[model samples]
Target: MDLQESFINSPDHHRIPLLSWAPQTPTAVLVIAHGMAEHAARYQPLAQWLNQHQVAVIAVQHRGHGPHCPDADLGHYADKRGWQKVVDDLQQVVVHARKQYPDLPLTLFGHSMGSFIAQAFTQKYGDQIDNLILCATNRVDKPKLRASLVLVRSIKALRGKRHRSRLIDNMTFGTFNKAFVPNRTSHDWLSRDPQQVDRYLKDPLCGFSCTAGLWSDFIGGMLDINPRVWRKDLPVHLLAGSCDPVGEMGRGFSRHVTNLRAAGVKVASERLFEGARHELVNETNADEVWHHILNCLRPETHSVTE
Candidate 1:
């Protein structure tokens, strides 16, 4: 694998660190939107595997994430218009990809929080991408999202935008781990693979709580996504874990697909792993997931959830 490192200048002059894995004469290029609280390095194995198949990979460390965070504080997006900036940051990545891998088909692969960013990107720039893959995504109820914003606002008013409130953190992610009682780690819901779970727990940048303002921005972005009015003629592939609590144990994922269909996605495909959890890319059957993803490039959308 040929690895390259560079820095992209965001609209606001933020220095966004980029990681690339390229194979000579690539077939396609993949621009990755990584999940929240984790950097782009975690996706190295997947990138390396894709390079072997002649698919190049490019990923960026988001505004408030990774060791090279240049603008916002750790666990925080900007205090205002943070979500929109995150979306813009993604666009910057796409722009970089277009120039770096010119004339190649591009796919946007987003996981968890990055899925929300990717969804918003498709809504804003549907004409730019060739394919969209949303993994571990969910539908957001508008009412709950509004209430969450209210709570985040109240907390921010009291604790400040940069404050890391345990109350807010627990309110957001506390229950996901409960699905697996007698758990060995707090992020057991991330994967069934113990080594992967341990890796996340050990990484300093993996599981930190975001600030109140960042939560407000994230949920605001979610509110903008669900029931979103957008149309695209491209293939959209949805992937998730059957028992993943983030999607409310699969109901939320279903609603998201329904929403996308209602919003006029031309070809939509879905697949759920029976016993898998969040972070399908890091799960034990990750190779299968990767192969399944490659199969989707053929432009056939299936309704079956196998």
Candidate 2:
């Protein structure tokens, strides 16, 4: 099915594009937020599957990540401007969806950096969604790390160039592609089958590098969404890849499952696939991943096990 994208005009008429797949039976509406440097179109497969099962999907391309990004440079998000702008844009989309699908069950799905936005969105718009799903959600690190990033950026600024050094930023996290998959060809982290990774690597928009400031902003944003700061008691589901480098906090997430339950929130479920990488929804075993996700969206199908 083809997706229809609409330009959302917010104040400056920033064209925020949206993709929708209308379902025949119309069980629910899944609103998706893509990770850093990626557009919303990548989630088309998931949206198509959901549509077949009588569910619609609406995906929003964040302010600076789309083809029409305001800042064509790397360091735009190093500051809070880009991140906050995306959050507001996402909220606007949520409001728009509620108006369009008032009676259907609304589910918010986020991956990686998008998960941070989804969690933050839940805090502000908790009553609007029935279920919140976060995949490959990054956890906060020590305050010293945050300070170090600031110091590094300050030193770079002193050199007379704006933004942090791209080399340093690349060394830090760009190595993630290597860490998670070892050889990008050995196995596709997104799917259980080898072809899935092949498709991802071939996809022009799948992965791209971010600025040091953008990296710092992302980590800081996750800190802001830590379950500690999570105030929404809505049904929440956390999914991470066991072998995924981004899933560094799998054990930590398990350790704190009780805390989430005590907060009047249902853990609904938390799953860590044996060797799945960052993007579970698009994994080779996506059918399995999609099953669990749909289960979370439907209260009748909720299961504690993966």
Question: How badly does each model clash, as a count of residue pairs?
Answer: 0, 6
lDDT of 2 at 235: 77
Model 2: CA > 4 A from native: 70-80, 144-148, 155-164, 178-194, 226-232, 255-265, 301-306
User: Which residue pairs in model 2 clash with each other?
Assistant: 78-213, 190-283, 191-283, 191-284, 192-284, 192-285
lDDT of 1 by residue, 1-306 (tens): 867889988878888788999998788888899988788999999999888777899997887899876434888988788999989888998998999888988999998999989989888887788888988988868888898899898999998998888988777667888889897878888999999999998998879888888888898888887434554677788989988888878889888888778777754688877888998989998988878777665344322232
Residue pairs in steric clash, candidate 1?
A: none
How much RMSD separates candidate 2 from the native structure?
3.4
Summing lDDT over every window of 10 consecutive residues in candidate 1, give the lowest-scoring window: 297-306
Write down the TM-score for model 2: 0.84
